[model samples]
Target: MAGRWKNDLNWSDTTPKAAWLNRRQIMAGIGAAAFGGIAGPALAGLGAVKSDFSTVEEPNPLDHITSYCNYYEFGTGKEDPARNAHMLNTDGWQVEIDGLVDKPGTWTMDDILAGTTLEERIYRFRCVEAWSMVIPWVGFELSDLLARVGVQSGAKYVAFETALRPDEMPGVRSPVIDWPYVEGLRLDEAMNPLTILATGLYDEPIPNQNGAPIRLVVPWKYGFKSIKSIVRISLTDKEPPTSWNKTNGREYGFYSNVNPTVDHPRWSQASERVIGGGILAKRKPTLLFNGYGEQVADLYDGMDLAKFY
Candidate 1:
């Protein structure tokens, strides 16, 4: 798998480790003062092998990557997650695995991470809102985890659900789309080698705002399809209902691939604004599958993306 794709990005493309550690230090200090000397656990550095799936482009700055986010569980604003995500307690996180599987039960984080090797994949992330960024994500393939639990023959699709604690997630208090946001993928898509359950960003434990502990990272799909703070994963025989698609099926499709030709109902998807690019930086033309067409286009062979999307 290492040589299946070209290796274009390297350590230089990532934010310096020193800078990331310095930022964490400042954040820890602030947390201590804000929570009566009780700071969050110190994040352990993750060691992962570089992957060929990474793009050649330089990644977005740590500031932009951490500050600008879309975890609606915290709030709808881009900065709200960073400001309010501390309340989310990932201390004893558990993901309930059920539906068509040989072994179905609530599994701890340790269970999810066992018997898997991590890799650093610097992938291009495209949001349905017509914005994009290059991020260095550390995780193993989603297939590994699925294999560990044993996917049953009857399972045709995989569904995911985010944690929904109103006490911790303030945004859930309001009627925003639906509580316990859900998303899904066909069995083949879920098993794709490119799909991963990210545990860290820039080699550090993923920040709360960016789906700490674990989150799905499917580079070819819109950011929303890559659900965050996942609490449940079900292998089902039927296609599962996705939160955004349920809210407005016309705009947010289940297959939400980054197709430049398919314009959003509210805006154009032909071009995207780079997150860390200067204000004057020109919006670049969007690419099909966020420029991962070579790797994922075959999955949609013989199907009309515009119709399916």
Candidate 2:
């Protein structure tokens, strides 16, 4: 089944597999030594075995995915994150898991990844701005981490917070959105298998501009819903504040699912531009659940996605 998707991919629409494979070994943390001297350079040949969890298309190149990003902590421009995110210090990074959990405290990145097994997922990343990219992310399911903390019975939602350091983060100084950007998801949504704690891309350690250390990846939702550079996670009974929604609720709703039928107040969501699809690339039809409804539709079975979105 997975092979069918890989074979059906429109090569012209994605990064070439052979070229991307050759550069895979360059990923920082998952080098040959890290994966027991895997012979190939590309992650696709190493431990990154193709899985049914991935999308049918090929992923965008690491260069495009890393160079173009929205890490407001660095700056507002599309090229800002790549240039300014370097100021961030990720060494010995730690995450504080608190609120309605059985075990709540600070856990170092090493500790969190110690026993976790990594897997590759080629997911479609759709930004709220109507641009998209296919990414090969490396990490474990978000549910696995949540299980480690032992969610309590009363917990209904999961809140996340990005690190705040005025000295390192220049964008925080501006009142653009808010400091220490926050995002949240329903407990069930967090537990969904499609949700993951992404640690790397292209099977290598994630770049600082691209949410180094750790970040959330909710494939079914818009890209912004997948917050980056996370430092805090909490289990709560109420919905936590999200940066965009807090800035303007009318434009960015709590559940920012990708719905072509429901257009954003500023523009239509009926179609989106593919980021790595080249200068002449045309907009493609946006899919329900980003073409992942079969895997995640049941989560919102009774609710009107248009209203919730």
Candidate 3:
């Protein structure tokens, strides 16, 4: 896949970390010159690849990131998730992996974590609501997890389901959106390196409202595509149904990539407001593929984005 796409982005220009993280750093030494002629901020834990991770934007402040969220399970208000998500019990969480896979079973969160390594991925998060943020997520590539289950030849899409405990998640009772919140990705999108199965953020455990235990993080797509509090992942031959798309397919498509030119039915998507940029933060032009076109544009070659979207 590396050679499949043209390398247009300056991947070498990446942030640096401690000398102990990898051999490159060890060889460079603490006092050694930084690579790519770009000095990057130091990050702890398994550092991200300079080429794949964003080196430009700073992650949104933890408070802003946590306090402002759209977890409908808690409520519709932005602050609802942060305030009501605590009722969700994350301990002993088990995810059911089934449908068109070699290995299908119920696996605990501990099992999932033990099977993969965590990395710090700094990604640009664009919301369909025309808001954006930079988040540093800690997790392994989603491809790694799918590989563990062994994607079958017949599988064409990956479907996800959020926990649906109405008692714990009060918002499920409401009809604002479909209950047992669901989302999906084409097989190719699921296998993309940028797609992650995030477990934590800011080097700490994920908060309850932010999809604690585990969640899908597809930086290139709208934030809604990144489902939260995931409890199931299914591989299927048919295109899986998604929550927003079900409510009104005209507005939300199955492939909700970040395209500034493709305006949402209700509002313009050409520009997005930076989430944590204070009260007066001006709107910034939305980037194709959320500024990751060089890495993922090939996936949609020749397809009409406006139609798929």
Backbone atom clashes (below 3 Å) for every candidate? 0, 1, 0
Q: Supply candidate 2's per-residue lDDT for 285.
A: 91
Residue pairs whose backbone atoms clash in candidate 3: none
Model 2 weakest 10-residue run by lDDT: 1-10
Residue 238 Cα positional deviation in candidate 2, in Å, after optimal superposition: 0.6
Model 2, 206-249: lDDT tens per residue?
Answer: 88999988999998899999999899999999999999999999
The TM-score, computed over Cα atoms with residue i paired to residue i, of candidate 1 is 0.90
lDDT against the true structure, each candidate: 0.88, 0.85, 0.84
lDDT of 3 at 93: 96
| Model 3 Cα lDDT, one tens digit per residue, 111-189 | 8877365766778999899998898887778888888889999999999999999989988889988788999999999
Compare candidates 1 and 3 on lDDT and give the better one. Answer: 1
Query: Candidate 2 vs candidate 3: which has greater lDDT?
Result: 2
Which lDDT value does model 2 have at 249?
92
Clashing pairs in 2: 25-41
Candidate 3 error regions (>4 Å): 1-51
Clashing pairs in 1: none
- Could you tell me the TM-score of candidate 3? 0.84
**Which residue ranges in model 2 land beyond 4 Å of their true spot?**
1-18, 21-49
